[model samples]
Each structure stands twice: as C-alpha cells, then as structure tokens.
Target chain A: MCTYRTTTLTVAGSGKGAEGWFPVTDASVYFDHPVHAPADHTLNVDLRNPSRGASARVAVELDPVSARALALAILDMLDSAPAGLVDAATPSGVPPAG
Target chain B: MTPGDLTAETVTITGHGGDAVEAYLAQPLAGPPAGGVVVIHHMPGYDAGTKEIVRKFAANGYPAIMPNLYFREAPGASPDDAAAVARAAGGVPDERLVGDVAGALGHLRALPGSNGKVATIGYCSGGRQSFLAACSLDLDAAVDCYGAFVLTAPPDEFPLQVGPLGHLVGDLSCPMLGLFGADDKYPGPEEVAEFEAALGRAGKDVEFHSYEGAGHAFFNTDRPSFRPEAANDGWERIWEFFGRHLSA
Candidate 1:
C-alpha cells in the first residue's frame, strides 16, 4: 500500500550526500514502501537541500522499531548534553539563555 | 532488428499541457504490429524496477512506454531523489495524470507498426491512475494492480490529495482487469467486493482476482512483498486479458 501520508518540515542543518556535504533545508518523513530497503514498508526519511538540486539529499529507510530506537537515541543524546552547551548552540538570532 | 530482440531507450514526449516529459520506451526489434501498453510506475518514481516492467512488455511483443511522472518536479535527478521531491509536494494530480496518459496513448498510436490498440497497466498508486485513465480516455484495456483509494477513501488522517474514484465506474472506457492481494489493508477484500459490485452495476466488462495469503505488491520482484505463485498467475491473467481486448 502506498500510504500517502508524509510529514514535512523545514530544517537548518548540513547533511552528507553523494557529492559531499550540503546544507539541508527540508526534511520529509514517511512510512511507506522503500526505494532500496528490503522490507515491504519502512520508515523513510529524506533530508534534502532543494536549492542544491534533488541529488543533494541524505536518505534513510529503517524498520519501524529501528526508527523508533533512533528517534529515542536522538532525544536521549540531546537530554544528556550539558545545558550551557545546548544553549550556546542555538541560532545566533535567537535570544541567549535567560 | 532481429525477431525477439528488444530495444529500450529514453525519449521525450509531450505530457500535460503539452509539456515535454522524459519517458522510457521499449519495443521489440522486430514483430508484427501489436498492441501498445502504457506502463505507469509506482509511487516510488520511475526507477529500474518499473523500467524493467516496461522492458518486459516489449519482450512480450508489446510496445510500452512509461512517462516519468516526477520529471516536472525533479528533472535530471536520480529516481529516489525525484520520488522524494514529488512525495513532498503531494502526489500527482488526477487531471495531470489523465493528460499524461492521453499523451502517452497518442505516442503509442503514432509508433510505426502500431495497431492503434492501447492498454494501461499500473502498480500501486499507478494502479489507481490506470483505472482513472481508463475512465477518462479511450483505451482497449486497463489493469489495476493493488490500486488503493479506488473503492473507498483513505483514512482521514492520511494527507492524500486524492479521493475515492468509485464515481468513475460508469465512465470506464475499456475492459478492466484488477489484481489484488486479499490481505491488503487499503483496498481490503471488502473494498474490492464493493468495487466489483459497482462495476457490475455499471455493466462494465471487468475481471477481478484476489490472491489469498498475498498482500500488496505481490508482483514487485525487488520487494519482500513479492509472491511468486500469485505474481506468476497474475501475469498469465494480464496476458489473457490484453490478448482478448488489445490484440490486433
């Protein structure tokens, strides 16, 4: 089944694609049939820099369990980071830590 | 051009609004004038697997073509990249898909040795589009392989731009063959039954077969969903259906 459900967001980050590193401006997450993954359906994530062209993308297709684990790991890493360092990493235009 | 030899190449064809779109065309090197098939790629975009299906049609003596549905969104991009871009924007519009299929039909009819008979076969989302094209265009036959959102609407949570096409049954312009996996949740057995009933009510020439124990994408060789027994039988049914309707 081609689940037409997709969640998209604008992100400011760099991702390594086929041609090395590029700034990624957009990200789309969907649970659907994968392009290369062996599973019938997987959680697919495409981090892309549309301004740089379609090839400027880093993609991942993970099983649902693995994707959940990865998501939890990301949150854990962020939660465990030093508070000051996390605040310092915020975008420059944003207000500094109160 | 020896008999049984085939040639597959990339070509440009006019699509919706007369826009030039890239397409893959495959035809037997030498054969009698035969029916043409418009192979619609799945939602994954125009990749090697779909191209292989196009070639399979040619190998079976039918001239086939597949327009890159995402070419407008991401021209020159890799298949996966193009697919991602297209998916982000929203799936292809039904009107645009119809126009593209019309263009592909024209291209097929214009080919040398064409018998002027054409059919459509699509997988996944393309399956629904195949049914859509058959409803909107003049075709000899159409095959819908596990196309969802045809008999029933997607769940409210699904952010799909398209809706159920049950209303188009009366407009179907050709013989239709539907192959489905009984276990598929989208167009589950109940939905398939409703669709079949509607087709019958419309007095349409339709044939449907649901393979037990086979889920969606049973014919997709590259995916884990491939079910050889069902896929093989489905291919035979397709050939028979086409032969009955599209042969010169």
Candidate 2:
C-alpha cells in the first residue's frame, strides 16, 4: 500500500466566482471534523473557477473525500467561514487562504 | 418479481468428500428465469444474512443461489454459530475454494429454472474467490466487492493457494467488474491500482470503481460500516454489467 501523509488546512478567508464550485476540481478538501472550517468569515476570493491570478472567498463544505483531495492539493493553508454558515462544515468556493 | 415474490427452496448439495454445503435456491414466483446468479458468502461462512442477500437478487428477476461454503458444518446448522461453522470448515484451503465454487456453478446450470449463462457476485473473502471464478470458471461475468489481497501478494507467494489469480493472469478468460471502497484498509486504492495494472498487463478487460468515503464491505447494508451511496451505485453497475453479459 502507498503511504499518504495527512495534511490539515485552517480556513483563513471566504467568496463568489463567475462560475459555481466544481466539486471535483475546486480548491477545498473535505473532512469529518467541523473544526476543518470556521463559520461566519467572508471569503476574500472567488469560490468558483478563478481566472489566472483572480481570487474570491466563498464558503467551503467538503465531504470526506473532497476534503482529502483538497487537503492534498493545498497542504498548509487556512480559510475562514462566512457568517450564517448553517451547514455541518464549510463548502468549497470559499476564497483561497492568505 | 422482488425477493418477496420468489419461491425459494432450501437444499443441501454434497461436495467432493461427502462434505455437505447448504444453499438457498430462489426462483421467480411468476415467470421464467431472467438469468442465473450465484451469490458467494463472505469469509464468515453462509448464514441468514447471506440468505437475505440471495432473496434480494431473486427479487430482481434472476434465480439466485446462495451456497454454504463450510462443508464441515452440517447443512442447516444454526445460523447463530457462524464462527464455529467456519472453524469446522478448516479455513477453506485456498486450492479447494475455486473448484468448490465451480462445482456450485455446475449445480446452478443444471437447476430447472436456470439458464446456462451464469454470473457470480461475492463480498470480502468471497470477492477474492469471485475473481478466481472469473479467471477459471467459464462464467459470463463476475462482481467482486472489496475483496482485498487480489494479485498483490509478495513474489515468493506468486501462486497463492486461495485463488492463484496472479498466476492465472494471462489465462483470464472472462470479464469482471470490481467495486472497492476507496478508504478500505485491506484493498485500498493502492492495492486496487496494482491489481488493475496487473490485469492490464495480462490484457484483460475490467470495469473498476473506487468510491470515495466508502470502506470495506460497503455493499453489506446490515453491517455498521455500510455506505448506502456507494453500495447503491455499485449495485446499479453490477446489474448493468450482468445484463450486458448474461442477457438472453
């Protein structure tokens, strides 16, 4: 079996994008723990597909698999959740972590 | 017809050495056979849970057979004593399992309601065995559920007694569909990848899926770890595969 190092990302920031979040390729990863995302923090970047160098902040809530994939892609970043985030965890489309 | 609509009979079939294997034969209550499906039980040996699985297939319009792999236990032993039954069966010597399953397939073909074509579906240990059946038995198709340790053994054990699937690589004569839980401990993503590569190397066709958030025994709804989403999706895939391969 291949060994995969587990990495955690703290939500730093939140936002909307021209297009909505694409679960398979978005920046967010999913986890079982809610601590993976903090609520009420607006994303400063785009949550949907970003033009090269463009950024947004959207809420990110990922299922366990999506979270893992996102975590693997961005190993050490944090994003803050937007206000009134009523879900168990944040959804992806949140802005990138600063 | 659904499982509730089947006319199932409980019967005992004698194995190579007077070893008796229990089985449930379910036929459609209203019509002719849609197809023949042989359901293999997981490592713990056949029990009420396995019987229920057979009924599920029967309800789908196929005549399903659930075989008791542990011949050591008398046919119809109390389902409560599963562990004892497995122990009595002496751990299913690897070499014998394939032949035994083939024997079961032969039995199914001869049944009155059955068509000559067959598909075998198995979980866990049965999953590994199902692969072997696909390789060795002249079946139309096979569905393997999270059967770990398939073709990933060390070089020294190149020929595993259980199925010897690795050795049977170039000789694989049938097509198979494999469903695995991405997070399963035994046959995790890495193992599935390697198995896929091996099949590719041997020039075999496979339809494989590794569902995220799903783990071992994902299809076993009665178990605590069952992943309903993955299981349902996998069942649809299996049904399509069987329909394509075993169709009249």
Candidate 3:
C-alpha cells in the first residue's frame, strides 16, 4: 500500500549526493514502499536541496527495526558530542551571521 | 495485427494546466490504425519497470503512453526521488490526474495510426486514478489493478484524506476491469466488493477478478510480492479485455 503520510522540514546542512556534496535545504521523511528495498514498507528519508533540483538528494530506506536503531544511534552520537554542540535549537537552512 | 517492430521513446506532453511533462510513448512500427492505452505509474514514480509495461502494450500491438506525473516536482530526478517529493506534497491531486489522463487521451487520438479508441490502466495508487479518470472522462475502458481508497479512506494517521469516490460510480463513462488479490489489506476483499456493489447498483459495466493466493503488487515483477501465476493470468485477462474493446 502507498501510505501518503509524510513529514517535511527545512534543514541547514550538506549531504553527499550523486554529484558530490551539496547544501541541503529540505528533508522529507515517510514510511512507505521502498523503491529498491525488498520490504513492503520502510522508513524513508530524503535529504534534498530543492534549489538545486530534485536530483540533489540523498535517500535512505530502512526497515522499521533498523530505522529505530539508527535513530537511537544518531541521538547517541549527538549526545556524546561536546555540550552545546550539535544542538537542534541552532537555526538552520541559512549561512551563519558574520 | 500487421507485421511490425516495436518502437519506444521519451516525449513531452501537456499535462494538467498545460504543463509540459515528460512522457514515454511506445507503438508498433508499421501496424494499421491501432487503439491506444494510457499507463499510469505506481506510487514508486515513473521508473523503468513501468516503462517496460508501456513497451509490453506496444509489443502486444497497442500504442501506449505513460506520463511522468512528478515531472514538475522533480524533473530529471530518479523515479524514487521524484516519488518522495510528490509524496511530501500530498500525492497527486484528483483534478490534476484527470487533466493529465484527458491530455493523454487526446494525444493518443491524434496519433497517425490511432483507432480513435483509448483506455486507461494503472497500478497501486494509479489504480484508483484509473477509476477516477473513467468516472470523470470519456474513456473507452479502464483497468484498476489493486487500487485502494476508492470507497474507503486510509486510516487518519496517514494524512491523505482524498475521500471516497464511490459516489461517482454513476458517472463512469467507460467499462471497468478490476483485478485484485484477496490478501491485499488496502482494498482487501471488502472494499473491492463495495466498489463492485456501487457500480452494480449504478448498472455500470464492470468486471472484477480476485486471485486466491496473491496480494497487492503481484504484477510488479521486481518486487518480493510478485506472483508469477497470478501475474500471468492477469496479463491474459488484460489482453483479452483490451482486445475486445481496443482492436481497430
């Protein structure tokens, strides 16, 4: 089934895409059919730069268990970073003020 | 059918709002005037697999075309990326789908070898769109392969609330062929029955087949859910249906 549920957000970061690293301004996450994954449904994440066009994207499709595990791993790595660093509160999708 | 080779290529066609969307067209090289089919890609976007389906229709002697429904959202992007973008945008709207199919129908009718008969066939999300197009347009025939939410909406958590289209059954402009898997939970058996009932009550021309041991995406040869036996039978049914309605 094609579940149309999607969560979208703007993010300030760089992702290594097919052409090389590019600034990513948007991110979309959903749990639906995977194009290449054999699973019926998977948690899919698309980090994109709409300004650069749709091809400027990094995509990942993971089964539910693996997705959850990856989420925990990401949080753990961020938590272990120096305090005040890697904070979600920091403004994004823009260059920092000089 | 006249002796001819199959030709397939990418082209551009007007879609909803006169937008120039990329499309794929396939036809028999030297056949007499032939009927046409409009193939709608699944939610996975207009990928290579669906292109093969378009080519299949050509090889079987019917000219076919598939519109890149996500071209505006992700032009030149891979099918998967385009699908992700389209999904985030709340999927394809019903009005846009109708417009695209209408354009496709008109384009088909204008081809040099056209028979002036056109039909629509779709898979997954496209299945519902096919039914929608038939209800809203003047197509000759429609095939809905395991389309869901035509009579029932997905759970509220999914965010897509396009609503049921059963009320339009009475407005259907063409005969409909529905193929489903008894095991698919989306349309399942109950929804398919309801859809059939609505059409029946409307006295619409409808034919439905549910394979016992198959499930959704059974026609997708690359998927884990591909059911060869069911797919083979489904293809046979499709050919028979198209032949009866589309042969010039």
Ranking by lDDT: 1, 3, 2
The window of 10 residues in a row where model 1 chain B has the poorest summed lDDT is B152-161
Q: Residue by residue across B88-117, what tens digits does model 3's lDDT show?
A: 677788899989888888888999989999
lDDT of 3 by residue, A10-81 (tens): 888789999999988888888878888998789999998877877888999999999999999998987897
DockQ-based CAPRI category assigned to the predicted complex of candidate 1: medium
Model 1 clash pairs?
A: none
Best by the TM-score measure: 1
Candidate 2 local lDDT, residue B97: 66
Which candidate ranks first by lDDT, i.e. highest?
A: 1
lDDT of 2: 0.63
The digit string of per-residue lDDT tens for model 1 on A6-95 reads: 888888768899999988889999999998888989999999988888899999999999999999999898789877776677563233
The per-candidate count of clashes, in order, stands at 0, 44, 1
Q: Report how far off residue B11 is in candidate 1 (Å).
A: 0.8
Ordered from best to worst TM-score, the candidate numbers read 1, 3, 2
Report each candidate's C-alpha RMSD, comma-separated, in the order given.
2.1, 17.3, 2.5
Q: Is candidate 1 or candidate 2 better by TM-score?
A: 1
Over 4 Å off in model 3, which ranges? Answer: A80-82, A86-89, A93-98, B1-4, B154-161
